[model samples]
Target chain A: MLKSAKMVMERARELAAKRRPVVAIAGAEDDDVLRAVSEAVRAGIVGATLVGQEVRIHALLEELGEDRNSFEIVNAENPKAVIALSVELCSSGRAQILMKGKVSTPDLMKAVLSPRAGLKVGKLLSHCAVLEATGYHKLLSITDGGVLSNPDFNDKLAIVENAVHVSRVIGVAEPKVGLLGVMNEPDPDFPSTIEAAAVARSCYVKGMTKYIEGPLTMGTIFRQMPEGATWKSDVVGDADILVAHSIEEANIAVKALINLRGAIFMGVITGAKVPLSLVSRADPPENKLASLALAAVISGASK
Target chain B: MTFQELQTRAQHIRPARMDVVGATPFEISIIEKWEKRGWKVRYREGELEHCLQAAVDAAACGETDLLFCSGADNLKLIRFLDRAVSRDYKPLTMLQGFEVPSYPKVLWVGFTPMARYDSIPDAIKGVSVVAKSMAELGEPEARIALLSCVELISPGVHSTIWEATLAHMSQRGQFGKARVDGPLAFDLAVSPQAVSNKGFKSEIHGQADVVIPPDLNSFCTLTDEIHLTGPHTAVGIVVGGPCPIALPPHRDERHMTLSLQVASLLV
Candidate 1:
C-alpha cells in the first residue's frame, strides 16, 4: 500500500518509468503548467502533448530556456478548442491522462462531461484529494470535495467505487473506506448518519471496496481507537479513503489539512474514462507535478 | 449518599429555592436527604398537571428558582415551560463519568436533540449553552467537542456543517469561556492515544470537558447504550432556562440523588 503522498508519487514514477503514459494538457499556455510538464518529462514520469496556441507555447518554452522540439505541441484557436482537442487525444488513446491548464474549472469539467467528447464513463464524476500530512502514517484520500455538492445514497456508492478504483490503481490491495459522520453511532435525526448507515450496510453485498464503516469520525481514521469503544474493526485507525458525506465537508477538511496542518496534497477527478489531473490555480508547481503523477498511476492501473 | 457528605460537596452552592411537584416515596426519600443537609424543599402532591400548575404558581409568586418534577417521563412539560418562560430551553443530558474509565471527569451535553431549532443551529446553541453552564459549575474553562460522524461538512450532512459553523464561532469568541472544537467524533474528543496516533494537534483532543451530540435521537440511543451495556451512570437536566430543572432518569434513589446533585451544581 502507498502509505504517504510521497510514496504515491514514487509509485507513479516507478510505473511511468516502466511504461511512460502520455498526458495531454488543455490550455497549456500557462507557465506553471509548462513548468510542471517539463519537470514530469525530465523525471520520465510522463510524455506530454501540449494542446493550446502553438505560437505562445513555443514562445514560453523558449523563454523558459527549453527546446521547443523536446515535446509535441498541438495548435488550437481558443480554450474551448484546446479542451476539445485534448479530450480527443485521450479518447483516441493517444494520451492516457488529461491535464488542466489555464482553463476555468467549470470549462474544463464541461468539456470532460460533454456527451460529444465521449470522455464520460457512465460513472459519477467526482473529485478525490490525496493528502500526506506530518502525523498520518499513510496517504489519505478524501472524495467529492470539488464536485457533487449533495451526493445521495447511490452517489455515495459511486464515489466509493471511484475512490476504490483510484486506490487499486495505486497498488492498494484492499482499501478501507470510512463513511464519515458526526459520531460513530447512527442517528435518524441527522439524515447523513442514516445515509452513512445505509451505505455501510450495503457495502457487505456491494463488495466494491474491501472494508467500509460508517458514522466514523476523523478520530477513528487518524487517531488511535479510544478505550471502551464497543465497535471494533480494522477500519478504525487504518482507513485509506474517507468517504465524506458532502462536498462542503470534504472541501473544508481537505483545505484545513493543507492550510492549517501544512499537508501536501494532489487532487484528481475520477470516474472518467481516463483520470483527469485537476490542480487548482493556487496550487504550487510541485502539487501540479504530483497531480500529473497521480493521473499517470491511475491511467496505468486502468489499463 | 449521606447528609454530611452532601453538605460538604454542596457547600459551594447556595441555599437554592426549589419546588418539588408530584413526588413519589422514592423522590421524597431523596428530597429528605437534601433537607437533612439544610436545604429547603417545597412539596406539591399530584400528577403532571398538578406539577405544572404548581410550577406556574411558584414562578408567578417568585418562590422558586429551580423546579423538580418526579415521574415526568416525556419532555412535554419542559417544552411547555420553555414556551411559557419564553427562553429557549435546551435539554442537556450529561454522562456522569468518562467514556474511558481512566479519563478525568467531563460534561457531555446535547444528547437530547433540540426540538426548537432545526438540527444544526439547535445543536450549536445547545452545545454553547451547556459549555457555558459547565463553566459556571467551576470548570472555569470548558473544552467542548461538537460531535458528528466526521469532522468535515457535507451539504446533505447538515449537522457537520453546523458543527463547523459552531467551531468557527467559538474561534471568533462567540461562545464565552468555552473552547469549542467540532465536528469531532467520540474518540477524537476524548482519546489522547487516538489524538497522538492520528498526529492531530487539538486542545480538546482527549481532554474534552463536554461532548455535544448532533441530535436528540442519537443522544437517547447513546444514553441507553451506556446505561444498559456499561457500568457508568448517566444523568440529565434541562438548562438554558430561567433556572436549572431536574429531570431524573428514573424515580429510583440513585437517579434522584444524581438529579439533585446535578441541580445543586447548577445552583
Candidate 2:
C-alpha cells in the first residue's frame, strides 16, 4: 500500500541501493528533465545517461550547481535520433529504463516500437499512472490514460496485468483491481463494457488475480460501504487500483483527482521488455520527479 | 395488457418519444400502444448487437426525444446506455433500489450464484425496516413491507458460499434493512405448495417482490420467464452507475422503443 509518496520513494531508494537501474534520458532539451534526473541520482534511485546534446545537459547541470562529471553524457543529434539512440541503449542492456525528456510521445514510442533499436516482447504497449492521494491511505494506480484510447476487454486485461506488476513491485502483495463502470452489470447492448468486467472477474476466479469487481463508479469505490447491509468486497473503502473503461474517463478522472483532490501522480509504460517513463508536458516538477522515481523502482523489480 | 389500455396508461406519463431494439412480442405491443397515443416510436431488430453504435448515432443525431432500449443482452448494452445518459447536460441516474408503495415488507432472497450482496449495510437495512415499517403503520396510504434476505441454490458444495458471503456483507453493513434467508431452492421460492412440501413456514414463502438470483444466468432466465409467461408486464431500468438507463420491456420491440425514448428523458 502506498501510505505516502515518501514511502514509495523510500522503497525506490532501497531498490536502487541494491543495484541501480541504468536509465537513458532521451530528448534532453529542457531543464525540468535534467533537474529530475539530478534528484533521482542524488536519491540513489537511478543512474542517468543523457542521450541528447551533451553541452545543454552540462550547462543545465552547471546552472543547478551540480557536478556535471557525475552523470554520463552521450552526444547525439535531435530529439528523434536521441530517442532512437536511447532505444538502442535499452536493447543492448546499456540501460534498463527509458525516460522521456522534451520529445513528444509519438517520437518516443516510434523508437520504442521500432524493429531495430526497440525492445518488444509481443505485448501491447500501455500506460499506468500511479497516484498517492492525501485523502486516502494507500497509493492508487490508474491505467491507459496516456495510451490506448479505448481498449477492449482483452486490452483491459493487459492493462490490469501491467498495473498489478507495478503494485507488486511497489509492495502491494495482492492488489484489488476495480473495473470502473457506473453500474454493476453490463447493458446487453454495450458489449465492450460487460466484456471488460467479465474478463477481470474471470481472471480473479481463475487465480490469475487476487481481486476484481466492477460496474463500479469512482464514487462507489471511494465511498464507504452502507451502514446496515450485509455485503463486503476486498476493495471496499480502500482500493489500490482503479481501472477506467476508457482513456477519456481515465484522463478526466486522473486530472480531477490530482487537481481537485490534491493527489500526487506519476506514470510509467509497461508490457515492454523495459519500463519507459512517459511524463506529461503539463506535469509540474514534483510529478516529473515522482515518475522518474517510479521508473527506477520498475527498472529494479522488472529485472 | 391490451395495446389500447397500455397506450392510455403511457399517455398518463406523456412520454416525449420512443425507441426499441431486440424487442419481444410484448415489448412491440407496448410500442404500438404508445404510437396510438401519438407518441413517435422507433423499432429496430438485433439492436443489442449494435447498441453502442446505435446509441452514439441517437445521441449525435438527436432524432428521438427519449431513447429506451429493450431486448436481449441488456447487460451487454449497459455501456451504451451509460454513454447515452452522460453525453448530455442532464445526466441519467442509476438507482440502487426500487420504491414499492404497497409492500411494507421486502424479502431479499439471494440466489447462491450471485455474490453482489455478501454484506448488507446495517444502516441501509435499518433504514429500510425503520422507514417502511413506520410509514406502513402511521400513514393511511402506507403499506406494510417486510424486507428479508435469502439465498438460492448453486451447482456444487460452494453451497455454503452465499451464506458466508451474505453473512459477511451483513456483518460489514453493505445493504439496507432486510431479513436474509437462504440456500433456498428455486421450487420452494416460487410455489407455496413447494414451500409446504418442504415443511417451511415463512412470511416470504409465497409473496416476494424481488428475488436476487444466484448469478447472471438465473437472473436472465427468471426475468425472461416472468416476461414471457407471467400475466403482469415486466419493466427493468438500470441504476447504480454513472447514470440511469431506462431499459424497455425485455423482448417487446414496441415497448423497447418507448423505453429507450424514456431513457432519453433522463439522458
lDDT by residue (tens digit), candidate 1, A57-170:
999998998777768999998887898899999889999999888787678888888888788994779989988766566778888777786688899888988888888777
Off by over 4 Å in 2: A189-192, A225-232, B1-267
lDDT of 2 at A108: 81
Residue A220 of model 1 has an lDDT of 50
B84 in model 1: Cα distance from truth in Å? 13
Candidate 1 scores a chain A TM-score of: 0.93
Tens digits of per-residue lDDT for model 2, B224-245: 3233221333344543223234
Worst 10 residues of 1 chain B by lDDT: B92-101
